[model samples]
Target chain A: MTKYNLPVGPQHPALKEPASFWFKVEGEVIVDVDIRLGYNHRGIEKACESRNYIQCLYLLERICGICSHAHTTAFAQGVEEILGLEIPARAKYIRVIIAELERIHSHLLWLGVAGHEIGFDTLFMYAWRDRETVLDILELISGNRVNYAMNTIGGVRRDIDQAKREQILGMLDPLAERVKFYTDLVTSEPTCLARLENVAPVPADKAVALGTVGPTARASGIKVDVRRDDPYAAYAEIPFEVITSERGDLLGRAIVRLGEIGESVKIIKYALQNLPEGPLTVKAPRKVAAGEAVSRVEAPRGEDIHYVRADGSDHPERVKVRAPTLANLFAVGESMKGAYVADIPIVIASIDPCFSCTDRMIELVQSRTGTSSVMTWEELREYGIRWYGHGHRS
Target chain B: MCGQEQQRSDLARRDILAELCARFPGEVGEAAAPRPGRAWATVSREVLRPVTEFLLGCGPGAYLSTITAVDTGEEFQAIYHFWVAGTELNLRVRLDRREPAVPSIMDLHPGANFYEREIHDLMGIEVTGRGKLERLAVPDDWPEGHYPLRKDWPGLPGGESA
Candidate 1:
């Protein structure tokens, strides 16, 4: 029995993110996986070094279109630390509201993606339809749906007034009820259960050793969350539960994320109820003092970290962003071992998003896995889904 | 109240500093608690791995979040951001600007794999021990010696120095 190569991505139905993972397949089980990133490299980190502090906020927001606010919040927090600026209490609460709202939007988007991957279009359709509600709220608040440019240097750009607060609060209950509906469907639905349960189980010790973070680690019973581990914005002031599961599989990750949505709603409701009164944006100085700082935020995916170093003029010397997807990449490959080829898409989507891939290059020296593939991305996806659909008798 | 919490974390910072100082002679630099629940220490590149291993051994929560490199004109600073509990302990290792070389902490912290490859790709720092590192963030056709994040390199398309 010779182990052969089965390349799953660069662009495949399972990935869709335009990064390649070359897996060494022995029959149906994945023996070894090599990841190749950088299909969509925007050079944002390089771009951030040249741009001024205020300008960089907008640039950072575009890192991941789905979780744009997470990037800006992390970047803003890091820069503010260097400036030694304490934003108004009102700003912090607004930041929390916006952050949690973004979290809801992101996690829901992930749910839809996961649903689609597992061949259950009903959950996917329902989740995204409800996700539009969050987008609508974001558009109502920040004026743009995707990259809501709400966060600024000292605080957020626009204020959520009394009318706006009530409106935003109005959206939570209905969203929670809908999510609960999906929760029941996810846990009980035979289609979702057959594909997701006990698939890609990773132990807690392996997760910790791999340096996994946020909900992925929490799902594996790692007992960590940046919001609780290192308090930032109003996370220190607002109370919320850090969701976790000891199962450490696709089902466990899904459950942890579904539970977190409810917690995020609670935090947002509290924030609206105790809406602080003060100025929205504090005038920040042009020059940040020469210093260094690291700011971590719990993005919808996991831990979003921004490290800033200022050389005093205007432009920051260096701004390094560690997206949660990057931190969880290793563990994802770790969990993929011994899983059915059919379960690849759902298992990959189980970790939410990845392949905000760095612009990187690699050599492609592959061994033939019985039959070879030189198909387009969509073709490869169709081939994958087609093979898995028929009980792959290798 | 936040200030009091800062002081409490500062006590833990002192313990870390003392541990490093006792282990490595003439390698540790000034340690400061810049803000509450944060600590910064400067160390020479000679003892980067030991310091990282010691920190990782301190607790289960001690994890390498990411590694960042800064070119400050005369020197290139490699900042390793380690998170333990609520505390973020930063160990900044300064490398010479002329030939920036830092020992790779990948063996100690697996999370440092991409971070180190990223540093090697963009900043042109020699991350020794990760033999023949592949490009993580740079393009395939990118020239060998052009480091984008260095201060001298203008952040523009095709403005890379030959």
Candidate 2:
């Protein structure tokens, strides 16, 4: 058998996002894969340093068109923590509704992408059609469809009123039924089931070792969800379940994500029903006191972490973003091992890799994040031994 | 914060921090107060790999969320964000700006491979152990010396004129 290389996409039918992948193939088996990202990198992280806090909010929203709200939420949360400003409860509920709805849209969009990859255009069409309903609900609440500028430094920019809440609830029942139908279709339909089952098997232990996150990790039965583990916004108050599967393959990922849409729907419903009453935004000062904060949110793809460091300036001293897609990129390379060349698209799509978010650099030009005075390893070692040995006396 | 949920988050942070301090004696550095279920500690560049291993050893599989780097004028600070049992624990390592080099933790957390490469490309930090570090997210024709994310170099990007 001849060993050869096959290259797929900076642009391809299989990849909706811009990223290049080279797979080393021995006959049909994928021996190794090399991924090159940043075809669409616009240098957003460096840009964040120059922009004011409010402007940076809009800039962060543009990081990923699909998971815009997730990015913005992560960014705002970090800055707000540094400022020590707490948002009103009503704003928290609104943030949850919008974030979960964004999750629904993102997952549905991914399902459609997966379907399209396997020549299952019907599933693609069905998923996208239902996805429009989410977009419509987003518009009804936030006055925009894709980049809903819902989150701000102190709180959400827009509030969901009673009529809008009713409209959103009315939309979910039909959406839920459609989601259920799709779930059944993916599992029961012979062709759909065959394309996904065991295409790229990632055992639970291996998935954990690779540091995989989001539906990809959940599919392998890792049982990790940021929203549940570290409750932000209204996730602690509202109730929802984390979806996982033991299948550890493409099929498991599909099932987990499809199930997540259901969970997201329930979270949105609960949030609206128990909607708190208060102002959306408080008057946050223009300048953030000098400090550092890390904000993590479970994006549709996985856990999204944003770190912001303020130096008592109107513009942020440093802004760092770690998109979920970056966490799963290497894991994708690992999962591709021993997989057939034909399975490349779906296997990569299984992680739902969003390059538009991942490739953006969080590069900040300030040293010693908090302050410059850090002790050498020897000093810290002696300090730790002394403190612990003294038992409560530092 | 609910009593039970907050307790669980705090306990997780404390357990991981305790484990690190217990194993290394004086190496874990300073830890900040818990903020919104996330907290961080600073570590010298030398103990980065070991500290990462300890965090990963925390029960139920510690996940490395992502790696971020910042240039603090004279030194480049590499921050690794880890999520274990629901809370985010960050490790910050400062490297000399002139000869910016740090050991790659890809051996412990494979997910850091690409991130290290990305940091290498944009921040110009040398990830010695990760073999064949290639340019990621930067143009192929991009100059050899210019690192886009660093403070001084004003190469291709976010500016007044397009």
Candidate 3:
């Protein structure tokens, strides 16, 4: 049997970020996969080191475009903890609202990507089109779409007025109805289930042992949610159930995220109903005192932890971030082991891999011969054209 | 600063730190006072393996949460924050200024691969036994020896004003 290596992207159409997966395949089954990241490495951690407490918030938000609010919120919370400052009640409620909105947007994006991976164009279109509603709601509140600079050190930078609150509530009804319709379709639809069900089954024990977080762990029947376990923001006040599935497969993860969308709807409604009136942000000290603090938030992906140590300077002494994608990436490789080549993309997509957050550049070396081949983007494209069909057909 | 659950976590962490100190003797330095629901102890890089072993082996998989490095111009400090299933025993290991190197924990916990790589890239700390330490977060064309986090290192080209 001849062993062949297949390289997929630092620049592939399937991926949203720059990452390469070199797979050794025995006829169509992948024997082993070697992943290379860092192509999109913008030195985010380095950038954080240079920026002050306030500036770091904006920089961190850009870490992953989809989970921008999650990053900013976690970073701000860490700084706030170091300062020992309690955010205003109104700010807390607004933060929760934005966080839940970000979750809905992220899950919807993932669903659309998953649909696209499985050749379901209609599902992809529907998911993304509906996702625009959440984006619009976010824009109305924060004044921006992607990097909503709503978070500050002490509290939020923006406020939700009555008009904006009314607009958000009006949008929720149609949004929730559409989400429910899609959820039902995805669950009962034979084609969707056939591709996702039991494809990359990660057992409950394995998922926990491997430190999988977010919906990936929830799908594996783990009841651990950072929001529930270690309540932060207005999560303690808001009543919501943590969704989980015992199946521990691609479909299980999908179900957990989809169900959570309804829960987000419920949380947002509760927040709006009980929205308090007060100052949006408190006055933070210009110079941070010498202290260290850790903040963890349940991001759209999973647990996002930010560790900050300040040395009485505007700039942080040390800032450490552990994004959820870092944990789930390991599980992605584990899940791809027994899956078919055709199912590889879907299985990988199921983990909702965010290589942008965690990256290292590719260093290609021949498997059998041990010769290194540094292929450029154009050369890699040509190679794809030669092996697979024309770029469009593949 | 005092509560039933907080006190319990503090005591639990203290016991763990005391045991580690006794086990490592000179390697474990003076214990830092406990913070809210957390405790910390400083240790030399030599005792990192044993301390980690005791924590992860004796306890219920005191899962390694993160391995972070702080560059203080003159020296680089690598802090390994570990948390058990229930308790919080946050540990720290300080390395020398020059040639900051520590043994890789990939054999103990497979999840440490990326964390270690990140430390290597940003702090230029060598994880001694790790087969390959590729740049995890920095760009490929980034200048060598230009660790952005280091106190003395120059800022990025266009980053001064921003």
Evaluated on chain B only, what are the TM-scores of all the candidate structures, in order?
Answer: 0.81, 0.83, 0.79
TM-score of each: 0.91, 0.88, 0.84
Interface RMSD of each: 4.6, 3.3, 5.8
- Extract clashing residue pairs from model 1: A10-A19, A10-A20, A38-A358
Q: What is the lDDT of residue A55 in candidate 2?
A: 96
Better of 1 and 2 by TM-score: 1
The docking quality of candidate 3, as DockQ, is 0.27
lDDT of 2 by residue, A209-291 (tens): 88888898999998788787777888878767778999999999999999999989988999999998989998899998988
Instruction: For model 2, report DockQ.
Output: 0.39
Write the residue-wise lDDT of candidate 3 on A30-125 in tens digits. Answer: 678766666666566766666788889888887777888888888888888778789999999999999999999988988887776665768889
Q: A1-394, model 1: which lDDT tens digit per residue?
A: 5676766555322121235677776767778877666655667787887799989998888777877888899999998998989988999998898899998888898888777776666877898999999999999899999888999998988988889888888887999999898889888987677667788987888888788887789889987877766678887777677789999988888899899999899999999898888899889999888987889898888888899989888989888888888788778887888876566666667777642222222222345434553544334334456665675533
Error of 3 at B56 (Å): 4.0
DockQ of each: 0.42, 0.39, 0.27
For B1-162, candidate 3 gives per-residue lDDT tens digits of 133244234223335666667787877665763444355778877767777777776543346767878876567888786655443455677778777899987777776777888788777888987797877667767777766666676666667434
Error of 3 at B9 (Å): 16
Q: Rate the local accuracy (lDDT) of all candidates.
A: 0.78, 0.79, 0.75
